[model samples]
Target: MVFNRPKKRAIVESGDGGLGLGIATFIANGEDLGPIIRHSFESGKPEALMQNLRSIVKKKEVEIEELCRLHYEDFIFAVDELCGVLVDAR
Candidate 1:
C-alpha cells in the first residue's frame, strides 16, 4: 500500500492590527499586485493561470471600459492565470 502525505500549504499572514495587517495595508492600498502576480504566473500551471485570470475578471464584475479605465490593474493577475494553465498542460 502506498501512503501519500498531503502537501503543506503556504503560510499567509493575516490580521487587522498586527504586522500582517500592516503588510496587507501597504499591498492593498498600494493599488499594485504586479510583481507577485508575475511571479505567480511564472510559477504556476497553465490551466490554473487561465482559470485564475478569468475568475478574477468575473469576480471584479466590471466591464471592459471600467477595466481599461482602471488601466488593467488586474492584468498581471490574468497573466499569472494564463501561465498556470499553460504550464500544467500535459
Candidate 2:
C-alpha cells in the first residue's frame, strides 16, 4: 500500500476526467509522478504503481459547475442499492 493506507479520496475529477486538485500538489509538492510511475513498472512491482497513485487523489471531492454530479455520500462500500427503475435523466 502506498504510505501503508487506504486512500479514501479520488484523483481524477468526476466532472470531465481531468486532473484533480491533488495532482498539482502531487507533482509540485514533492516527488514527480513520472519517476514514481516508471519505477514501479520497471522494478517488476506493478501493484505499487496503483498503490502510490493514491497520493495524487487525496482531497475531498469538490463541486464543479457545468459537470455531472454524483452523490458520493450515497455510496455504500459493500452494499448494493437494489432498484427496478431509472428516473431523472435531466
Best by TM-score: 2
* lDDT tens digits by residue: candidate 1, 1-90: 999865443324433212222233334355355544554456554454345456556655666667687867588789988999999994
Candidate 2's clash total is 0
Off by over 4 Å in 2: 1-31, 55-90
What are the Cα lDDT values of the candidates?
0.52, 0.45
Predicted candidate 1, C-alpha RMSD: 19.6
> Lowest-lDDT window of 10 residues in candidate 1?
14-23
Angstrom error at residue 9, model 1:
20
